[model samples]
Target: MIAVVTVLLAFPLGYLLRSHLAANVAYAIAYLWAFTFQTLYLTLSMLGGDDSAFSKNEFPISYGLVAAGIFGIGFGLVALGHRVGSRRTTRQAVS
Candidate 1:
């Protein structure tokens, strides 16, 4: 649920901000760092205070999926940046 929303939101935002290559790269790095921190936090939480059979089983999978989502966002942003930059170059050449 949350994972899906994060991916969907991140993709378009990344795309829209893709024109600024440095900024986009920084943003993607920041996102990756943040997600890593989130994984650590989740792991700590699960280890410190957890119960039942399901908690141990589900945590790793959920975390991996979220990481995948973040990667997808980063890739989408890079691709969008390339597309936007190329288009701008083409238009400038024509003019």
Candidate 2:
């Protein structure tokens, strides 16, 4: 169910932003990160750790960190892709 939604959302977004390699890479990274976090969250939640106070506090903090990391990775990928694409475009334009 979640996987279906993720794919549906990710594909067109990736395609529409494809013209800018940076945007494509950003979308991919963000989707991948979100997928990873969701998988981890579901797995942990299914294991039944929610009954504890420690679990409640830890989970939210962990989730926040995961989200931040995902955003950072996505931005990093976008920046790298943008640099590479710019170089390629410049080279082609020169030639």
TM-score of each candidate structure, all chains considered together: 0.53, 0.49
Clash pairs for candidate 2: none
lDDT of 1 by residue, 1-95 (tens): 33443455444554455355654565566666677776666667778875431276555565577567767766675567557766767788999
Give candidate 1 misplaced runs (Cα > 4 Å): 1-28, 50-54, 57-59
What local lDDT score does residue 62 receive in model 2, on the 0 to 100 scale?
64
Encode model 2's per-residue lDDT on 1-95: one tens digit a residue.
Answer: 23443445444443344366646665766576666777676668756865442354345576556555755555555555556656766788999
CA lDDT of each prediction against the hidden true structure: 0.60, 0.56
Question: Runs in model 2 with CA error above 4 Å?
Answer: 1-54, 57-59
